[model samples]
Target: MGLRAKKFTPEVLLSAPRRSEGIPNSDASKVLYSVSTYSFDDHAKASEIRLLDSKSQESSLVTDKNGSSEPQWLDDDTVLLLHGDEGGVTHIKVGPVQHFGDGSYIAGTIDGPVGNVKLVRIGNGTYGVALTGKVKPCGDLYNPEKAEKPVTTGREFDSLFVRHWDHYTTENRNAIFLATLYKEADKYKLSELKNALKGSKLESPIDPFGGTDNFDISTHGLVFTAKDPDLNPATHTKTNIYLSASKNFWLDIAKGLPEFFEVPISNFEGASTSPVWDKTGTSIAFLSMKTDGYESDKNQLFVIPDYVTPGWVIHHFPGGSSGQGTWDRSPQSIAWGGNDTLYLTAEAKGRMNLFTAAARPTGLNPVPSQLVKGGYITSVKVLNSGDIFLTSTSLIESSLYSTVPADHAKRTLSGQSYYTLPVDESPYDPKSSQLITKYVSSSTHCGGMFGIYGHQVSEISWPGAADDTDIHAFVIKPSNFKEGKTYPLAYLIHGGPQGAWGDSWSTRWNPVLFAEQGYVVITPNPTGSTGYGQKFVDAIQNQWGGLPYEDLVLGFDYIQKNLPYVDTDHAVALGASYGGYMMNWIQGHDLGRKFKALVTHDGVFSMTSQLASEELYFPFHDLGGTLWNNSESWSKWDPSRFAGNWATPHLIVHSELDYRLTMNEGLSAFNVLQTKGVHSKLLYFPDENHWVLKPENSLKWHEVVFDWINEHAGLEKYTVWRAGNVKKQPEDS
Candidate 1:
């Protein structure tokens, strides 16, 4: 008897009735954070901690709050947790694991001074800390007695025009204070808490999104923070690493007591942060950039040597291909397990994988292996045994897993031997793991299903680059697809031009959603995508609209011609960021009538305005200059220059707080559509940043986008006309 294939419906895929989230944090810990949800709309917004017993091989769930920031083990019994509030205090809780129902463990917050912790580091029973204080600038160190009290108009007020992500203001400026950990019989508490840095206006963890992870303290009581300078936050933010002994320091502008001393020199010309202390102390390893003013430049791994003068010793690792030890892939965070073992979460192809290498500069091209890939590895923790516990999420899975090298101490030192994952070379699967349960829902009234449930999701490749480079693309077939039936295509262009539409699951631009809407979805990760190799990625650098665009065209042509069922005539081009720029390019350039409609979200309209986006370094490094210096270089790629030919109906989406693209970008495109009198609609999210994160907003965004695409391209062409938009013959594709 032949085996029957599993058939799923859109309702089953979109509904996603029930699923348990694995640990979302990449930070290493004995307990993992897991959150379960009934549906997208039915989630309680709280997280659960999954504690595994090494001795018993048993796992239990602990109820936790969504406010929990970074969770780290305090000791054998206690765990330190950081919680942040937008309008309230930063809660720092440290206590022994609390057992709740049955075998579940819930960490209870310590009800003490630790409640206002902005950043913390725990060692045995001793905790080094930084607390937040709201202080209005007064000439310079007005009165220590009046530091806590709000100042009326008795003294001059210092002003800073700070703007970030979504909002701006001076009221939330925080002053960093230092403290010591004191425990009262198992109850964690804070003692000797004083203004470690006074009379200075500096937010250690920055604000909004940054927290404990941005700052690190050395074993010798030296605090290193990559922080926002006390000045007007502008389109360009230059964050220099400040190293100061863990003592009371002050920055009085009037008296000139610079709060923190900056690093004098570095291998890279740009900003630096994420300092990881070597286990033996005396040195620091951090992520660095080569171009000043550009935050998105090639991220290189650098180490700070124990020298008499303050400077960084750049290490030439695998990614650091430049003679000076610079790598292209961006390093998110760094952690040291041993003196020579440095583990990094870096981006390549499309996945953020864990890599291991020597901790210091060897002037050697330290080959870093993708210990764990096929997903987004957010953070890592180093245990005494050298085993790594990490949180990884994919296009279809979520959670944490543990991986141990055969002999990491030796492998990392050699920087040549490869590390391995518990699972073999396959997509990260959550269903096979015993820790998480398969989502089962008895309720039939939830919502709809999606692409992954009803169709096959696979990655395909075709020749694209001039050197016959094979460009990778992700394709999702429609649900219950039949032979000889043509389906409309949702050709999605990924942003980043430097980024890729990875193999992982996503809440935004979900191809499965389009597949559920009765369209064959194809997402091409042409040149500039990571994972492929440095050459393929570097090809898209100065040639953003060049090689990457050509590769997309070739990939699209191949997909339509080869798939047979992909209805190219009735298709649409959709993208965000750099992809959006290509959508505009399509309206002016190639594929005359390939896409019936277009959807662009948070995409660039003009390189001129996009140059100084958020940080000046990105434009400076990528384009090689600003709008003034290299007007001719960026001019050719400007979408508005060729807007006269934009006849296709378009849906423009942008956010007010997306400093990267800025609100004017969408407005400019919308204005051009109005001037051209083209069929267009502008969807604006005032509260959202670059991505639509809010639940309701996201739902609305999906509904609007889903409905728009269906109405324009995904809708079924019921009537069988002699010659419809669909291909008359497979060969015509």
Candidate 2:
């Protein structure tokens, strides 16, 4: 029956850091670094930040109540901190260089009217601070506590501008120079900050034909990282480097921009990130790739001398790729322990650990210094005493650990180094794991919501349940959920008809906001979800709307019968991309009368039209072959095949720049719903691409979705949770 729900055993979910880099070093053999974790509380919540000491094993928390991140150490005792709140605040805080337990930390606020501050140290004790805020007349310092007039009003700061300032140069004074946005405006305007920070400002000379990629500033000069799209074997897939500096201090001798260095193609590739220069500023060390970007491998160390002429020479260490092809062995948190020694935090065989490399431009001799099993090494930093501090996390909590060099052997710090930073570790279910388990579990609700979190079900056993066809489902219950009370359920379908729902934080398609709004949100990976092995993924090769439709129906049936607390009659089916395809499919197929409304986000309706369009060629490739070759299969599964039967009220959402699915898909779906006289609405974002990434746009998106749900389902009333204008609903014609 309906492909027997394909018995699938889900694989273990692998979690790793998305971004990691060593912080700017304050002194010789002393460097600070930071790491981030997906928040268990809310997806919108800012990542946790901790300060690590490399010399004397110790770590400390840097963020406060609202959330702190992007920490840049200004000096040994002072750090520039940025808080991720509605009004992003940037200021300098004076704190202890080394972390001590007992919850004792001394921090002094540096008063300024800057809204979002991005700080970069240009020279010794001299820093560049970028200020962005709403324009208003300069009056009393725009302190949150004592501002009489609206200081940040008028046009908001959409640009980033850099100004030279010094932290240790003045005890309590901050000397800020507001610069003009390059080319856009002249005469020392403060708004020009954004343009100067773009990759184009620090242009790359490596491939004059290669467009600007990414760039950063270092002590030696500005390093611009780029990729050549036309290169053989896809150049710069993982390794990245900087061009050599020129004789003139203002220009780089490596070619391209006068102020930037171009990285040689031979030395760069394989997902390279976080490039830093040595204390001597004569050589640069960066994470090098041993395999393709998608492969799970520990990035090896690659060194290049800054003085190498014409082209830079690359060196790989012996046994350097020891952990290659393994997810748990990637090296992170790299810093210079000394001019000759490089320290890094790594994970191997599912254990978080540390390693040291005595490097030379010719070759690297790496040695395994420490092994931290059973926990994750999130960050590492070196101290003046040659001690190493690290921030670590387990499933239960995050803590700080320290180690010091003793008799030439590194040892954990005694009672003096370990510090337990205060963190809200309230148990929030891991949505990714739940989803995985549910997909593999045998239950009668073959596809219904079963887990405690999105797309995961803990118990798949249902009354009178038989056969392995039962698909388990997971739903994220609201934070302050009541035991027996019913809540509106939002049935979410993931894109990639091939993609499965898992427990991970998505900056886009955030389900936490719905849970926070007192709604039960459900996501079912269905068949063809990745991470469950190759067979399951291959199941949906050309069966997009066939067996998958039945799985969803069975899931709905199970949820309605078992989850009485989930107002099944008031549920809304929502999805984007491929998920949107399912929504239209369900509407046309008349799968169930349970859902009161639906939302289709940039989904394909007419597969025939989509295949003919030039915009959808890549997606066609991902689906196995072109529609021309599989015309019968494509037509059979096309949502437009059953469009004439669609009667469910729906809301269509899409972005103008979404070339993948294109706005035409949403527009066509909306037009069909309107012609059929079905109750429907449309929301179009002009500036956003496939996903709404802007902060303001994200807020508006949430507001609009909630408003649409409330209008049709009679859910909770809307209210502004944070400061910002709430977007008004477009008038229904």
Candidate 3:
């Protein structure tokens, strides 16, 4: 059979980090607190650890490494440390240090396979350890028989058993307490322990304005930082420190102890809390949003003194007030540092850096200073001997370092031995960029059916490509593509009218995956893509289907003339969301008979209806005003006006739970297609949301769309050619 006449099977487009999930963290500081480089050689991998000192400086390693180590101060001469394995298991060890980087130390392993652990002083000469682990009825602390042992005294205690415990206080010992989620406040005594622990059950705290919540907690009062709502798929409100403590420690408060502070509704409304107590325990410092309309920045510092009015006195930091900076600066880690001085780790110069501040009066602002520049610093610990321990990271590696606060000289401690991993190179390298090309070929084409690895071709460019323009095209000659044969081209549109179709990784919208299905896919970032600049982004504002649409059409024409093998008669218009909106709009206005099929996914049909029913007013604000205010512009570009003219066969795929665009928008377009008797079908996912987050539903969505395109375009018979294998034809035969 001729190359163009062979029956081809479509290829499945798979996402890289395929079986291996992408590391869940966006910033390196969040994953590896402190980094220290050991060697500068090409072959020698560097090592690093999260340490206790803030001023310690180190270099990057040249080799590959694994896991992490965090150091904590046991005393002036000794330290308690955690060594983590590749499997995420952490081992506790106690060690002695000589100098900052003396390369000298003796250490002893204390506990193995421990989960999360925090140190607490229980009593005079005694300490209480709180951790997160499985609870067993009665198991030996050392030498467990099972591969997985149940925890008896950690965060998992409540899951194993439920019991009410009384609150009590001892003279000098620190106390550790645990409880189930069922217990209420007024049960735990807070005054008896050297330090108190509280736990919260809310996954995320709900806002007073009725937005989604974002908090989660274990049995103890340690507050885990809540992630950005946009970044995390899970959305719950994280409780304020007072509420979290009241929920878990209220049951254990002693009868004679001071009354628990009542958390004001204003504090919980639109802000989160990070509570840090002074060593004297008479004062507390917290981070909160100043919602009083005076301060627009979401991060501010507040202090509460027991002797004062018992309410918090708010103070705005340098970057805490609105218009002071462009980035959001939250105090991640804070230390007392004695002499009323406070050391904090925060994002300063586009990266995480260390800063110091001194406490003034309750209502007075503290003087701030930048202690360290660049790199991300985690936790800072000040020892009685006037030395500091900290965990920090450079662009390449993370490690533990200590320095005398007086001179600021720093040195590496442990975890300095394994800086040999290649993956620990310059932390600033564009890791996401490398994954994009792999994802494009693995999944984008063939309805995500097959995977193809290791294929190289030439760069296809446009006549006016610029330095700022990263536009590259690929051509896959059909496996059965005869010497004189031609095939239909599918100009696939990417969503994120603001998003770019670059050499970046995407779990969806794969081109190779589409190519495997026997259709040539052409995708271009018309404008408003990120990476480009402010002008490109602002170009699409209120001009959705204008110049950007022109760019797509121009690119299409360029490809058609450059690649004559494509059959213009069988061309199709396919896209989802914004892309869907473009397809619906163009089909009505443009006289393009080359495209025989149109597949729209959750597209916007009527801007008027959309502007009226959208959950928020921002979309309208972004449009420069309400539809009534911009009727002339809205009417000239609205897709609904063109719906009456659409004649191309189309398939509409929408999810009912898509609040962003909503299901009504898709129905509006479907109604138009139905009235015109245009070959059309509406596929609805009742439980699915905007992105088809579910694995099974996503697979089904892809299958149905490809089936419709193949059936309408008459490419179903050549399924094998859709699998990514093609015959190379002569340049000019």
Q: What local lDDT score does residue 398 receive in model 2, on the 0 to 100 scale?
A: 22
For model 2, residues 1-733, the per-residue Cα lDDT tens digits are 1121111101001011222334534442333444543332254434445554544525456553444545566566555554433433343333443542223232323343443343444443344344433222232123444435557644433321111111011111211122211111211112212222132322222221221122333444444343333332111143345443444322221223343344553533454544555655566666655434322223555666654352564544434233332222346556666566666666432234555655553333333344333335555556555544454433222232333242122322111221221122222222322111001111111221111222222223222122243344446766557888998888888887656554333445755446655677776666655533333444676777866777787777777887887888788888888898889999998673568888888788888666433234233433445677867777778888788888888989988766556678888999999999998989899877667765556655666776677566667544432223222321121
Q: Each model's TM-score, in the order given?
A: 0.76, 0.50, 0.46
Residues 1-733 of candidate 1 have per-residue lDDT tens digits of 1111132222223333223322222232345443434254464344555555533434565435556544455555555566644434345665455553333232232222222343234455555655444444541212233336656744443643334556554454544555556566656665544544555545555655555455665444344554445434443445666666322222121133334666654445565667666665466777666555554555567676652234545554533345324454567788887776677887765667777766654665555554555456655766566656554555444333544433643554554433333222233244443212112111111111121331256678889866968888878876667889988889899887667786555656666656756788888888777666656666665676778778878887887779888898888889998888888777777663577888889988888897446555566556757678887778866777888888888889999889878889899998998788988889999999989876567766776676677677748432222135224422110
Candidate 3 residue 376 C-alpha distance from true site, Å: 22
Residue 83, model 1: Cα distance from true site in angstroms: 5.8
TM-score of 2: 0.50
Clashes of each: 26, 46, 128
**Which of candidates 1 and 2 is the stronger one according to lDDT?**
1
> Residue-wise lDDT of candidate 3 within 1-733, one digit each (tens)?
1112122222122111121111111111111233333221232333444322212322222112254344444444444445555443444444443332333222322232433344444334333343332222232122233345546634422121121111111111111222121112412111222122223122212221211112122222233223223321111222343423332232333322223343442443334555555554445566654332111123455555442344555454543234222223455556666546666666532245555666553344434555654334444656554344444432212222323242331211111111111122222222344211001010112111122221311236453222354333444443334566666777777676655454322345655456656676666566554333334544666777776676666677787787777776688878887788888877886734557889888777877765433232333433655577777776777888877788988899988777667788888888888999998999899887666745456556667777788776778733333344334321121
Model 2 lDDT-worst window of ten: 5-14
